[model samples]
Target: MRTIDECRAEVFRRSEEKIKARRRARVRAAALCVPLCLCAVIMSVAFMLPKGPRTEEDMMQEDGEAPGGASGTEFSNDLVGDGRDDDVNAPGGEGSLSVSFSLTWGTYGISSYDSATGRLVKATDATRPEDYVTTYRLTDEETELISELIRGLDIDRYPDVYDPQAGKLGSDPSMTLILSVRMGAKEKTVTAKNIALTYESEDPDGQLFLDVCREIVEILTGTEAWQSLPEYEFFYE
Candidate 1:
């Protein structure tokens, strides 16, 4: 049903559309190259182009010189673990002592020591350095013994060490250790209950405080003071 002239006209129309599409593609390609052209100009102005590959021989002459060479920080990867020093049973000594009493009566456990001959007492009942008050709380006998320990501790060295509630015991205000790390010259105080907790905490780089108390306990309670000691350990079980 078609003639040669009509077919020829349709062919000419398709050719025109293809030519327009090719021109549009060329225009888009030129647009895309515009930014590339700008970047090329920037690089050209920034640095001189290299003439050729520079081998080791070309770099050999400049080994000793640099533009602004400066030293960089270096670190060692050799460090391991958290401990800085690990040595026990060395020069440092340790000790601890505990006495049971009541805070309601305003009396707390007392201990005394003298390094001169290395003597320690619980109370001074008969003005004897060896004998100490056994029952009465803060009696003249106990006060004398406590005073001696206070003097030995170097009041000038341990201020603000005692706590206000140190010798405290039962909630009844009668049973307490009364160890107040505050007051006095170089004094640190703690109740018998707290003494146990402090030694257990043994914090800050290792038991330094525990060591000091251990020495004091050795003086006051003798070598076997803790042979039959009792402590509560489990909270849930």
Candidate 2:
């Protein structure tokens, strides 16, 4: 009973209804995502907020004042730590085994190496010090180095111990050793000595020395081989 024009209009109306329904569904889907997006934004903001910086209120409280006040800090240093600082026992004396060591390079300078990290590094303490505290890369190592010195030897196989009154065996080689060790200490003064071991060899053994020293430092100080001064105790300049 309807005209062709009327039928075409009905078809177009149906199409319009379908389009509207689709748009409504899309709006609902997008609405579902809003809460999740909002939650993510809130979490991001919370994570980025600064945590360590002191607030104005905190600062005021710390300064012992309100509003604007001069900031203050309280800190203290241990003039003396543990009994270790009070005594410096000699190397061989009874109940006196705490010792620090030093190496004298003169122009050659000291070198250090680290076995823990397998990293061999060098120290630029090229300028020698009047008094420096050093350690053996290893206690066993120190024993070896010291024993070797006592025997008058070098890194390479060379025997240089002198007989004093007797004639010296081999000629002087390339370099010399400057070994100074603090064996023990008293209430006021500590006991230390220096031993110079000359070598009949040449060539800068910086890298070799560094590796050896690093090991020694590790043994004596529980660190690496180069000794600066008193890493732990109180001492005079």
Candidate 3:
């Protein structure tokens, strides 16, 4: 019973309602997707960003602190060098310097030099200073040379122990070397186990430690008293 105009007007109103409903659905969908897309983009950007360089504190935490509570600042190959010099008598005034080197494996031995006593003692098959196989007095020049070498070395930069990958080398027959140096009241001792292997393995820290040990050993073995001592009876593989 409705007129044609009324029928047409009703159709137009129904079409407008359908269009508004579709527009509301699209707005709701867009509102839901906008935050999700932003979150995804933020996460991707964060993941793609590069990390910053490691600081000295990070390295110190990883490698641990050096002997005498020293920081790990100058622990590099440039600081540690092979102990060889054309001029053994480098000019340096003498002070209260004491150095000792001990090697242990199949046999035990220790070599010690003291500037106060002007005595160098080398003992084998014994640990005490009283049991010395060879003893010699160091001249003023000899003491100065030793003092120069010991003072030149920054022993505080070295760790107390140098053993690379300790868990893997447990079964192997390793030789332990202990070097102790005292300048005035300050003293530091460094112990290395199988340092040759560590040197060969190319560990930077271990290599530096080995170099310091070599410097001390060179100072000890290069002496006339050390050269006069007899060879070892037992050998270690």
Against the hidden reference, what TM-scores do the models get?
Answer: 0.23, 0.21, 0.42
How many backbone collisions does model 1 have? 40
lDDT of every model, 2 decimals: 0.33, 0.35, 0.47
Off by over 4 Å in 1: 1-107, 117-119, 124-130, 133-159, 162-198, 223-237
**In order, how many clashes per candidate?**
40, 25, 0
Could you give candidate 3's per-residue lDDT for residues 126-204 as a string of tens digits?
Answer: 4343545555555556454444443344445567875643434433444456656543333567665553333333554
lDDT of 1 by residue, 1-237 (tens): 689999999999999998896566434434433443344445444433457898787687445345333422111111110111121111222221112111210122334433322333443323452434222223334333333333232222333333223333224222223323222122244433333333323232113223334333433453332222222122211
What value does the lDDT take at residue 60 in candidate 2?
67
Best by TM-score: 3
TM-score between model 2 and native:
0.21
- Roughly what TM-score does model 3 have, to 2 decimal places? 0.42
Worst 10 residues of 1 by lDDT: 75-84
Q: Which stretches of candidate 3 lie over 4 Å from their true place?
A: 1-123, 126-132, 137-152, 164-172, 197-201
Native-vs-model 1 lDDT?
A: 0.33
